[model samples]
Target chain A: MENIFRIIVCIKQVPGTTEIKINPETNTLVREGIETVINPFDTYAIEEGVRIKERMQQSGSEAEVTAITMGPAQSESILREAISLGADKAILLSDRAFAGADTWATALTLKNAVKKLEGWRLIILGKQTLDGDTGQVGPELAHMLNIPFIGYASSIEHISGQKITVKRLAEDRYETFEVRLPAAISVGKDINVPRVPSLRGKLKAKNETIPVLNIADLSMDEKDAGLSGSYTQVIKIFTPKHVYEVKMIEGSPDEQAEELFTKLKQLNIV
Target chain B: MEIKVDKTTCTGCSLCKNFCMYDAIEITGGKAIINDNCIFCGACIDACKFKSIEITGIHEKNFDFSAYSGVMIFIEQHEGTVAEVSYELLSEGRKLADALGSKLYGIMPGYELKEKISGIFNYGIDRLYIADNEIFKHNIDDIYSKILVQAINKYRPDIFLGGATSFGRTLLPKVAAIIKTGLTADCTALSIDPEKKILLQTRPTFGGNVLATIITRNARPQMATVRPHVMAKEPVQNAENRQTDNYLKYSDRIEFLEFDPLNFKTKYKLLSREKELGQSINLSDYDVIVSGGRGIGGPDNFSLIKELADSLGGVVGASRAAVDSNWISYPHQVGQTGKTVNPKVYIACGISGAIQHLAGMQTSDIIIAINRDPDAPIFKIANYGIVGDLFEIIPRLIKKIKNGKGIT
Candidate 1:
């Protein structure tokens, strides 16, 4: 029998941070009806995971991939899209109890869900979710799982049998680590070229029934599912105080050049 | 208050250690490390003329809750080894603990972290509240928040602290939510009020503009994430009175760790320098910059700017263009995409600065812009403007600078 690898990739849907506009009057994110998309970094993670599974199948090895997310019912679209991209399964950890969860609670719930899944060969993650840009989940998940994690991975090499070695990105140099089976690795945009899902794959994903698990279903303590279990809370979410008032850069070269230099020099920039 | 010594920029600047009346700094590996007992009086930081010393860990304090009590530091670890930031938090914790007339505790979750427990004895922790398991190793927010909530509910500490690393950032917010407590991220300051016995949580708001001080009057365990390199990590001076009251609460903590074998394959790896672990920047004080941008067109063209910069005894810079185009190293990018510089003279050969681009380097003393675009933002800020193609002006500028005829 061929050695099989199972990969779980974590993705989050967030209000496009770049597109996030604050209500000028209230100074809060304009959430009355906002456009949301899968976090940019996570797309890299998903694409990389799909790429790994394809490579495994190409090499005549067993590889199964799962795309998992924890969000509301509306968040199901991203998973369906992931399924179309060749994820073996799509799992959602969603419930009213998970609402208003902090990073800690989200991590724990995912960890518990991972435990429920039991056996897996590789856990792929994005370096950060764009919404918060905290870049904490992967390392935190690794910490909670008590496994060696290679962070900000740029390349994957030497994958065979029960062992995998990845090129971990570090300050000034890259270090290679050979981790045993069963490790969580967070990848960045530098990881790989993600493949676009084929039409057939997208069609199949449309019919797939993604599974959803709640705290009650997982036998999780209610206190641990939401705000009760979190260590940090956003006391308030307000718009930034100093808005970049979109100063247009349009003027004559000589005068504008002089004006720019004077302002920066006064601010003591250059 | 914290004073960060960018070890690389520290040119044996003992002014910090010498100026520190509390004797908080000790130079190691050719860098200054703040030892314990350093208070945030801004004395040594102000004395460091090189400005290499940055105050990060310190935040404002809110002392409104006279009924608050206890100081707690979240013990963050990687692969069973505790991170140094947690210890720094502990050092800060002791002061908060004293102000509350209570004890300092290290809150951690894991299995078999006992070997590391001995180190906290010298840090003045009154207790080690630990919940460990095979599943607890990965920092899953749900599991950890739940466990921490259990621990906090059981013990009811007043102040909670975590390092501003990835793990703490993820988990702290969860714990704060569960407990309905207010939290400040990347806190640069933390203190306690003597009169009210409450914790003060201060963090920068509006992209490091104003300092926002928050207080949790009704919530237990007021929380904050302390930036690294602010508070001094005190060397154990005396710990005769220190005690480790271990609370073994494994009853409710879940068995939640699961491991997945990872695939390690990629076309390229992030250069180690980008991660900055076990390493530091050594170019914080370079007098001149010779930066390039996507305007150079490719990595090969970087040689032009490199040669020009080399001739000027300066370094190279880039617009976010160069970094995004992958034409140069991310470290070399000059815009908001890379390091913010205030060098004596910044030369923008082909760069057209965006507003985000200018925000980072608007402080350069003399900006010389050489762009074909007369409308380029760089020209607007340039002290000396050259409205010519960089491809044309650069070679001439290089020759002129080499022949000592460029600047006037």
Candidate 2:
């Protein structure tokens, strides 16, 4: 075993698109039946982690990579999916006591799990989950763990010993940063394309038995977890009060152009 | 029952004293004396100096918020893994639990359930309902819907909330369909209804043109999906799981196809990626904002916008017309479907008052809009609106603010 850094990569599954249809009868999204994919952003985290691990091994450094996931009983598939991506190990944080957890709570759980992994030197996460799109957990987790948080990382620049640097993308510009090890880095969807699992990797991951943890074993109680421990409350969910149909004017190119100019003239659009 | 009173204009109006039967008020030193016993009634609000008495409604008309209820969060997981939005939802859920009385529960189904359920507990979820089954694994529409459909039927919860995630955005509709109910999507605000026993769903319509509050009148389980980042995340003071439920059984009706990993090229890619080595979408990751309006003139002048954004280490934003006119790129436009930004600072340049534009940035923490016209509708929402030419104002203002230290 060489001195490659020990890293943990976290990923999540999500709906792929924003323009989804709603079940008119149900008044909710018509997800009952559509395909769900890994959150586009989280895949970047997996890719970056795997790349780092691969490079470390190439350089003759011993780097151990693992995937961590927190989800429902059905979510183990995600860990298996992570394993197929070349992670050496995967851990699932499951328990009835961990339900209804918000961002801070979720990060707290991840932090606790990482704490148990003695040699963890880095944690990689997606810039944001497509579903909530809040992008708050990485920073909050970093703050909680007293570690540095690098957000919106577009690419990894260099990694040497306990010092690591990355190029963070921020719309038309980039900021490079150097931080200590064991830090959390949130990457965007464009970071890299996650490759399909190889047959060998798949076979190994399929045989690997992932472990699960609960509130009791985590030394946490249900009283403060889930809804109780969260600081903000969602009092209600309702449709917006405003209602006005979009009336797009359509016609032949000339006619459409004429109508546009007419409306512009009428309203002095210019 | 929290109240804020302006101390300067209090004329010792005792009407508040008469209205508060809870003995939660005081009228010491010529101001309305609000005590702990005051029950947050608006009776005294109509009787104060310059009508400074504003009664904020903390509770809605559905659930009795003070009572203990299970922290029931509609899990927005992807392929069985928890989504970041789920964490945000849990953060907000935890807060709601503390405000009223409740425990957080993450509900999902699949076979061979893992410990992801417990991970959420550290985020403060008190319980998990992990129903393991094959159909629940792939987010199987019919199977997953039926499972939640069955679960809700059995659990009979007071409230069920999900994130506006893609899965949530898609699956909730189907689950609600299976249950034969209505669901609110993209809610910006949520409140508990003390009497109605319903979930109030507020979503913007006409592309954020208007905010509508919807309520499921007769549904058994009040279901709604909240937009991400709309609510503040709560910190995990401590974590503990109160209870957890295990698999009772699995249904064979649902088939799970362990999804073959996605090939990047097969999926819908963005129109184009940024050419610069270190570039990403700006609006996707910013806390403060400084936007530009038509006042700068012509799309070419947008370089001014870039300069300003660079100077402040912030993102540049534009009104609807700016994008429609092709003056700026599409990514920078802020509107209903265009983008929903809640930055700490929003600066509007030369843009006139347009409801569509206002719909997008009005919710910003602080709005500083500039226009030659003082009566521009933009000024209505602006904490600070300037009436001057952008050419004359921006450069000078930027220099002044940078040199003086504070613009406010």
Candidate 3:
């Protein structure tokens, strides 16, 4: 009998636009009217996860793909989007306790929720969250789970019954590694191009009810779960002041260079 | 848990001894003996055969966050060369340490770095920590993280800093996970909050659209990875201006981490190490650099950029967009995911400055931007801005330079 794989993918919701505004008094993001989307990198993770399930099924094996995320209730939209992209199940871990959580606390909450799922064969996540740009959660989760982790994986080479091989990316080169089952990998943008959801998949996702888990449901210690448990906190927010004055030279293509040339000569740089 | 060697399977090839960073293993009578200095990094386990070595036992514990003080910078060095980002962090860290009235220490882990130790002291560091061992010859994240965590537990630094390079990005998060602390990545600025006596870690979020200032009020070692070239390097000076005798602190008493070996077991094995080969162009070493972005149009269009660079005796660079479009190889890329260059003069041709691109090169001595769009963010930072097409402007500039009318 073939072993059925239980794959879990983590996703997040981020502002669709780069222009994020913060309320000075609250020091929090002004999210009342902003549009949101699944983090660009998370889409790639979802595509890879769904592809893995389809590949296994074609080979006469059973596999289930579950998409999980930690955020506000509105974040369920991304979970639905994941389901529409072929995820077999969707879970949203949301709670007031999870608010103001940094990467450390966030990873712990997800780790606890994952423990309840039991028998998870593999975990997939985006290389980093676009909103925070921390790239810490996946590695932290892998450490907390005591499993081997491969980050910024560009390709999956082979997968057998209890082993897998992947091409991991570095700054200048790629290194290949083989690891046993029950591992996790964070995929990069280059891994695969995501496919659009079909009409049927979208319809199913729109009607599906996502199960929401809270801190209490995960049986987590209050001291280890949210803002109180977060090791770091934000002190303030402000624009970085420019240290040097910018001198804008106004002119035509030829004239602009001529002006720049004169300035460089005066500065003894030419 | 303890790491034990099986007598029956041990071939005594002496491979384990060669890989141990600490003198924690000795092959006597054709069997490896574990010493007290062993932090259980598991490097020997990966290099062993015959299932001779196995880790047994487990120990769970917590650290007192209030006991740690001082600011420590992880001087990320590889193959005996310290990265430039380390110096930048040192200069910035020096300010933070002074603001808090605490001592500043530098920690370096690598092999064959005896000669480089003096070079680090030139930055005016108070204390220097070096872990010179064979296992540190190449960066293996798992081993390095264990060594770092143990060092933190012993020294109790209130604040820690590292470069946001590939080595630091992978290593620090793992260490933070074990220590149960927070780590802010790719910070653009760092400072100390006087009232709270906490580290202020400011970094960009939301694809570099907004900046968030974070503080580790509860954590002992408030950690951050600052991007290279964003901060200024301390000016080099004579040895008399530096603390020359700080190296004596580690003369005979090397603090090797004393921890249980079983907790550090890892299944990952490094098959090989490939040095970054080829591409003679190192952006940071050049004094003058000319870069092209999507505005350059195509791969062949880069010739204009190269011509300008050649005329000035400088190097040609590219933005991430140009590299992603296959217009040029990644070696020419200069951005957040690419190289952070700190040249004396940086010329941007047709590159609409995205935050990601600007974060990499905003610290240049002088910036010259030539773009058609006046409102492009690149113009705001340009010391000399020209609102024009690069194709038309670059050729005229090249002609003037070649004729020795503008540049001598």
Candidate 4:
């Protein structure tokens, strides 16, 4: 019997448009005008957290869901969006010191932020982000916190008191794990279908104010909080040159397969 | 500190056995053996008659990055079958090693793989490191990362490569974190600088809208994972005997090292694992793949794509949209987040070819796109573009294939 089950859902705002252009000289994304939204994967995480909170409430247990994001101040919109989808509170870890951070530094910042909360039963995260597909943040954060981590969680089977059972998706198999409280999990998109915000919820979200946290607020120093703490550095970015060329087989469907089959035979791929 | 014995150079000298105070050295058969109790105190090295023992210190002050050599590939296996990406990586890794004038090595961890990887030497690997332990049968990220980190630290390969499969995606990041090195995910191309001997890793970013070439810059034993089918698997040809089958016996060029995993630890435990609920289709094996998208309308329409796939003797693939819509199974989805397929011929029906989708199948030999919208992004990459209703076009393609006029 727990008085309150506190869960933290981490979210990130990534570029929404696919028409991203690179600055040829610097080899960096031109993020000036592109629209940004919550990372697509994080939406599933947010929904899962909210769903767990609802399940706790239905069972007559006091539960609170908090959504956290580490980005610029503009990322508050996604936190507010999380609120609209049933999050009880939202916190934004925003500061110039956190810019240019790699997954390690980002995890450090998130770990410090989580420590500031004092008590939390679980932390939920998306499998990975679109901008950086490293999939290292959740595990790295767990490493920092010295807690158990389960990646690729497909479903939450049950949660009782301080223990949670989850189904994780592996290659060609599905594994189930039972982890104690204070553990972190990164959920896959198959976990649950995120629900759309209702009109009433949207109205409430419009007026919500997200609290902002800076390096000073969490007592984290600059050297251990951002790019300075990161061990690996990206030296260059360029377009991958095509290793081989492809030949087109033109004409109707009948002619297309005919040409493809002939070419396959010629290449000895058949 | 670490203690090692070079099997090739040892000459069955038992003189060093008398110097070990802990009785860690034993004369087994003819060669001198170092047991687990050896404290690496270096007394035996001073007394070694043949001078076969090597001592390496782990302190940062004595560590030399220059001592690390060779390019290593992690051969991932599933249900006793080696993944195709392992061979593909070997093919690509050989070129990188040759450019740097380094030997190429492979590390495979599983329960039993002696027979499965017998043909690995044909790929030009100089040595094969194996850990055939029951703990490796299941995909446990923490345990696998621990073993790999130990192997990497011991072998000290300059560059390590793995396939960007589900296991690698989770495992490599943890390894990189523990070893404190750089790891690039889902790389499409790899090359050596030749001048500086750096691994140039290239991969897609920004939702597959842009490609980025990243370099480790400072880390030793640079690691990278490339998607399956991104590189062609070309075995080294043997002029002495050209076998009709792909597997050629080149055992002389390869050496084996059995990795000992007695000192590894992990916190998480796998309570149970069950087979996937639905049918599992290995999309990588098919030569021709027919995939549908949201344009197919509903779950019932997937049968149409199946009919076309059956007529072509191939498998049915679906877009993330179709899979999300519950029209098809998750295993059938083909996209950046799904499966990267390099089929001989790929037919995209009603799929708008999102950048995510293109990232998976764009490497196919020939892409034939059929969509009602002529300006669909898929048309840009399709060798043959069809602007018509898929319901109308797919049926005609299936009928023609069934009549043995277009396919056979």
Candidate 5:
């Protein structure tokens, strides 16, 4: 057991399209017929996790990658998909009590689930989810677990006994940092290109049965698992309205180009 | 929380089903039943006209909030100068502090910042806390979060604000989690709730298609990170006026703090730092930007966008679609997941604007759209729209500008 290392990748299932529409009468999102897929950013995380596992195993050390997600029962599809992408095992944390969890509660639930696993050395997640678009859960989960976190990691340089070096992309510069083990990292899309599932891997994944964990399984109290544990609540949700007065420059390409240049000049733009 | 629907009141008209974005409501046997998919967003409760859908079990917890006071903002600094977003936070924080009848404070943890401390007061910060040490030089999350959590526990500010920069987004959530509080990210709007006397943080979700207003009722210090350029910076006030009104010198307002770096042991160590190469031009810093999208056809066509930008003495930007297709690098991407820019002039070439792409550059002073499709959504938000092939129109425009013949 001491020779084995475990890498956990946290993922989410998000609506596949950005063309979400609101019902004109009800003024709410039309979720019907919308396809769901693993968040695009999380794909990079899964790839990086699998790459790390392969790199370590090549050196004659034991390593495994596990994919974890918290969503509806239907979300098991993504976990299976993760298995096809090289995850050795998958876990689905789903319960009626886990509904309405904000970032805080979501992180707490993840913390509890991670604690249940043995020989875990590192955790990986996407920098942010498309649907929530809040990039807080990774750092929050790390804090809850009392470990260091590095966000927006562009590359993982090396991993050795009790230490890992990661390159992070900041607003103005790229910084390289060395962190101790039992740390969490959230990666952006630039890290790696996610690989397509191999035919053999897909067959193995189709036959794999992912274990489902609920709040009770993790020994988490009911209040601390879902909406009751959430610190922030959404007070209102509405569609944003934009108003602009546009002037159409209608003519031949030359005429339109001339008019655009003249207008930009008038505005002192170009 | 528990949600229940009164079978007697539910007409099975399925009105509530239309409002549920989660697809949790099912009209089973002429009654609306909520399944496990419900996130308890309360949207159905509002949609039900008969008040049939109700959520219970939201009990108020007993927590003492009176121990917290004042509004505190994290002043982000790199090298020796303060980040521009910090000033914007100060300006917004000042308003929030004034509205709550509380004092506005700022916290800066850096090295050799003695000379730069007083200038921040011009933005209406009452007291600035300094943790000037050599170890505070780099923006290390492990060390910074520990220092911040210590400061937060000791000072206990009612409201905490930070700019939604790369550093803030990573650091604040760590602090919030350690302190067991709620934190809202990339807030576009902040105001004090008149009735509850609490902070209401509003931000866009679902790729800017929806806006959600959030509140932390029981948390000690409600935390929020605001996006840069979304809020206006207040005009800098003269030292004479501020000193005369306060009857105190700038030095009197400074509070120097001491912390033992060894106590906050962190396994994190900075190995190296380097500037991003190749793309030296920061799109946000430029006044004029020329962007291309999927209609640019391929990566090779980005040269046209770059040529036009260079001719205009601006920079090149790209829509998410173009970046996703590898037509351009991620640094040049402008959208929800990318940089939010507010340049003086924005030129869209061959870009059928998506809502996510529009969220980043809609705030530019002037927008010019060039697309073959007359009904492109970009035209709706653009000030001047040219319905023509970008390949032709852009070359002509660039040739005219390069010829330098259309003079004043």
Candidate 6:
């Protein structure tokens, strides 16, 4: 176990779709039937981790990929899904004390879990979760663990001898960086196309027993686990107001085009 | 912290259940029970008319926050050219500083940025802190975060703002974690609460379906990153008027900090940086954008969108459906998962806009929708809408523009 290379992939369970609706009369979110699934971006991270392990195995080395998640009890399903995808082991960090965690607290919780893992080589996570939409957890986790961090990785060029090269996709340019081991990386969706779980893998996932860790199990203080440790607090939540009255252009295709053209000309946009 | 429903006060009303986006509440046996799914967002607490829900254990810590003063903006640049978002942040930072009755400062880390320093002062920055060294030329998360943490400790700023660019998104979180503070990402709005005199950070969450106003009550240096084009950029004073009075005054206040580059060694080594080639046009830079969707039928049909964009001197854009269908690359995608653009005119051809897609481009000045479906959602937000086949309408629009018939 000490000789085997260890890769940890951080995953999350998010709403299956982003098409959330608000009850206009109640001014509240309509959440009765919305389903949850493994975050789409995290699937890529899981795939990349599995690919790294397979690559290592092809080179005649032993490697294992472990998936970890911090969410509610239902989130264990996503962990099992990660196993079906290719992760060798899965861990669920769920507790009532861990609720209401801001990015800082969430990263801190993850850091504690990583420390408990011990002897881990690399950590991978999705660039962001769709629900949170804040890409802060990865870097914050890295800082908490006192390790190097590389983000928005589009591809892994190579991994050899305690070093890994990753291609990062920035806004204006693509940068390639060679980072030392014991580092954390947040990969973008372009990393790889995730494969579907086979029947055998799904059967194995159905029977796999995942260990759940709470704040007490991680040796973390109750105050530092959730809302109490969060540096930021949300005071208000509301839907954005849209006040636009669309003017329909009624006529033939030529007439509609002419009217739009005239309007653009009037506005000095064309 | 602990969140619980006072079952004695709860009337079994499902009002709180509707407010929960996480579906954590269940009405079992005529009582609302908070299950494990609750993230403690407090949305239900607000919805419960009877005040049946409460979150306890949020004990406030006592720290000396009075020592922190002034508002600081991180100046991001590339190849000596300052990013446009930096100026935008400065403009917004100026307002926050004024509301707090404090000075607005700019912190820049780059190599040989002396020439560009003066232009930054025009944005009402009172003092500019410079870290001009060879090691600061390229952005490595480790080195930049260290420099930022050093500056933050030395000059304590109550509020710090940054652009939500690729660099800031990757770098600021590490800095915030190292400094042990709160940093919000992709904030849409920032304002100072008149009573508390704190920075109120507002951002879209749950896939832009809801907006959350956040506050760092217990942390100093409340940090946030704003996306480009989300805020308006206005010079403190006009360029012509500021040249003599404001610029000189601001320039005299510039401070060059000394940082030993040897002390900051990055664990990661930059191998190379290559500019993305082909179809790399930033859609936000264009005043007009012509987009296509799944209705375009196939990838070959995007040539029409490109042609229309070319005729208007704009850039080609695509809806997520089009991009996901492999009609075009992901860079051209305009939606929640893609780049947000607020062009002067956004022409959507054959797109039935989803809420996610509309979140990206709904801010555009003028939106024109052309779709065969008369009830397409794009038309709801569109300033001008056309109900017809885009294939027939686009060619005519492109030909009319190309014929120089509508030009001055």
Overall lDDT per candidate, in order of appearance = 0.63, 0.59, 0.76, 0.76, 0.85, 0.86
Compared to the true structure, candidate 4 yields what TM-score? 0.80
Task: Name the lDDT value of residue A6 in candidate 5.
Answer: 93
Best by DockQ: 6
Fnat value of model 2? 0.04
- Candidate 2's residue-wise lDDT over A199-224, tens digit each? 98889878999989777667775644
Candidate 3, residues B46-158: lDDT per residue as tens digits? Answer: 66756688765422235566677788899888677788889998888888888988877887777777666666665667777667677777677786788788788878898
Candidate 5 lDDT, B193-309, residue by residue in tens: 988789999988777767788999668799999988778888455644443322135667778766887886776888998887776346776888899999889999999999999
Model 2 segments beyond 4 Å from truth? A1-4, A15-20, A23-28, A32-36, A239-242, A248-251, A264-269, B1-408
Error of 5 at A89 (Å): 0.4
Model 3 quality (TM-score): 0.79
lDDT of 1 by residue, B1-408 (tens): 234677666787576664443345688877888753333335455556676876552223344444445776778775477787888888888877777678787677776675666566678777777666655655444556666776677667778888876456656755665565656566767777567555666654322212345455435667778866556788456664323333233212212223221321222222222334432232224556766765667888889988876765667777777777777665576643245566777777777766445645655656667677777766655666667556765675455445443343
Off by over 4 Å in 3: A18-33, A54-61, A242-245, A262-270, B1-66, B235-265, B276-289, B309-345, B353-365, B402-408
Give the deviation of candidate 3 from the true structure as CA RMSD.
17.2
Question: For each model in turn, which proportion of the native inter-chain contacts is also found?
Answer: 0.05, 0.04, 0.45, 0.34, 0.77, 0.81
What 10-residue stretch in candidate 2 chain A is worst by lDDT?
A237-246
Colliding pairs, model 4: B12-B30
Model 6's alpha-carbon lDDT is 0.86
TM-scores of the candidates in the order shown:
0.57, 0.46, 0.79, 0.80, 0.93, 0.95
What are the DockQ scores of the candidates, in order? 0.04, 0.03, 0.18, 0.18, 0.66, 0.72
Residue-level lDDT tens digits of model 6 in B1-408: 668889899998998887777779899988799988999888888788899998887868988899999999999998788999999999999999999999999999998776676777678878889888999899888888888888889999999888998889979998888888998999989999999999999988877777889999678899998988878888876653333323245557678788888998988899999887776656888899999998899999999999998888889999999988888988898977777788989999988988778878988888999999987878877998899988888898888777755554
The residue-by-residue lDDT of candidate 3 on A142-172, one tens digit each, is 8899887888887888775587787765665
Cα error of candidate 2 at position A270, Å: 2.8
Q: How are the candidates ranked when ordered by TM-score, highest leading?
A: 6, 5, 4, 3, 1, 2
Order the candidates by lDDT, highest first.
6, 5, 3, 4, 1, 2
Residue A61: error of model 2 in Å? 0.7
Shift in Å, residue B237, candidate 6: 2.2
Residues A1-270, candidate 4: write the lDDT tens digits: 357988899999876645444343443334334367788889999999989988988999888889999887778899989988888889999876675566777888998999998568889999988777767788778877877788889889988768889888676678898878888999877788899997867877888778899999989877665545554444443443333333444577666656545554565544
Runs with alpha carbons beyond 4 Å of true place in candidate 5? A22-32, B6-19, B28-31, B45-52, B236-249, B280-282, B359-365, B399-408
Error of 3 at B326 (Å): 5.7
